[model samples]
Target: MILLDDVHKTFGSVHAVRGVTFEVPPGQIVGLLGPNGAGKTTTIRMSVGYFMPDRGRVVIDGHDTRESPEAARSRIGYMPEATPLYPEMRVADYLDFRGRLFAMDRSSRREATARVMDRCDLTQVAHRRIGVLSKGFRQRVGLAAALLHDPPVLVLDEPTNGLDPAQIREVRGLVKELAAKRTMLISSHILSEVERLCDRLIVVSGGRVRGDGTPERLAAAASQEREYVLEARFDTDESARGFEAAVASLSGVASCSSSEPLDGAWRRFRVSARADGADLRESLAAAARARDIPVRELHALTPSLERAFHALADAGEEANP
Candidate 1:
């Protein structure tokens, strides 16, 4: 539903984005992740037509943002990090003003305002002034305004920022519910939130696209090798050392280390191996049985998205520096 191809932007001598390219498929929720000063907001602005890319294209639903900015922007609903709101206006009034800006008729404005208020759970607070409402309620007002026009695409930057646990949960749930019908591009610092909500991720650093894929795919791409956890019991420390030696002797095994002391005679070990398309569990079990070692448990450990994000960011920094 959205595409950025070789987009580049600069301010004075500082290049904010450099040949960054990615796509958000229809009915998909994609997360735009990056460290501070990595041009995430700049890229988002260009996508929404708030700022024009110095080079390349930003397209939304087949309309080029540079060539048909109004039409392209009309398809998108943008809720910025610091939601701009009229402090003195009531929630309903604020939504009405937003509808008016979209040139919605009086009847259409009322209908859209009512629908978004209900969707965002702001009905009870509709009569309250935005400044008097809680931060969470104010955020809902901003979101309601963004949805007033019923855009097919949503661009949300830090949608849950500055909210309490309860409020954050509320907002997250609403975003998820909205994603059922609309394409969403979310940029958040909360990695776990992104991991939970996003179908795919676009990792950016130093104004460049560093990685793009599903979370698991990105993690696997960043990981140098596979890891496995092994637990077993031995009669003596010498036997434990022997078991480690046997496991390390396996062809694909790169290194092995004791992770934790289990019970009186049981111990846990973390085994790292080369990405040789080999299943070490079978070999590990066979080796344990040969040495008369009782295997308690064995399983592979999947690399985390957080680790993958940092790895990509670090790689970008090193390449640019």
Candidate 2:
């Protein structure tokens, strides 16, 4: 349960967030994605009560961030992109200290510290100095510190920033588990991770929301063409050129090009179709059969998250500029 209504933030002449509005309902994980200067951090800061929006409201669970910073913040567990930690302090001790900062009572602090350590897999390293731990371990410590208060909403920026593949997967699993009880807002540069973990995405660019929807919906809306890869055996270079020409001339086909021979006689080709065109594999295969060309592989490539993100961002640039 988080909401931003026409939120706007600025620093000097730079307007970081402009008329941004979105809502994260309970039990949902929404990914925030954008390039470097897209104002994601600024927006998150306002949502967590670290910064007050200049023009609109940022309400956490029901508390207005500006009017009730403490209440709003109490509902959120924020783990920034580069979480600061005390290298000299032991992990368990550090978490306990954080609990105290949250105004947790001694009994509550002790219980929360132990629960977070176990949940974050930090129990084994409970007494180890944070400074000597690996980056992944440190990340876990930061995450553990955030959970000490048991907030209902989590705002995590680059939560998997310093972890290995296994650790990343572990964090992914943990986030998924937490989503059952807490609303989550995640910002990550990793598209694959976002696609896997988030139920929806909000793409921002040039201080505004450029896209918002499920990954498939956004990708489909942004895609202007469908791409396919076709690999087949050719008798000679001339035959390959002829095949390319034939495929390129097919109805709805936008372009077709061949690459150098792969393996031995098999050559790969890329075919693109207009945005409104149906699948061309059947027609391409029929034409090949008419020409007696031996087809080894043919498949349509789905629109990827990276491609959709760029398309939406570029659209924003053009519209704003």
lDDT of 1 at 198: 91
> What overall lDDT goes with each candidate model?
0.89, 0.92
Please, what are the lDDT tens digits per residue for candidate 2 over residues 7-125? 99989999889999999999999999998888889988888888999999999999998888898998899898888888999988898888888899999999999899899998889
Please provide TM-scores, in order, for all candidate models, with all chains considered together: 0.94, 0.96
Writing each residue's lDDT as its tens digit, candidate 1 over 168-210 gives: 8888888888888888999999999998889999999999999
Cα lDDT over the full model 2: 0.92
True-structure RMSD, every candidate: 1.7, 1.4
Show the colliding residue pairs in model 2: none
Q: After superposition, how far is residue 303 of candidate 2 from its true place, in Å?
A: 0.5
Clashes of 1: 0
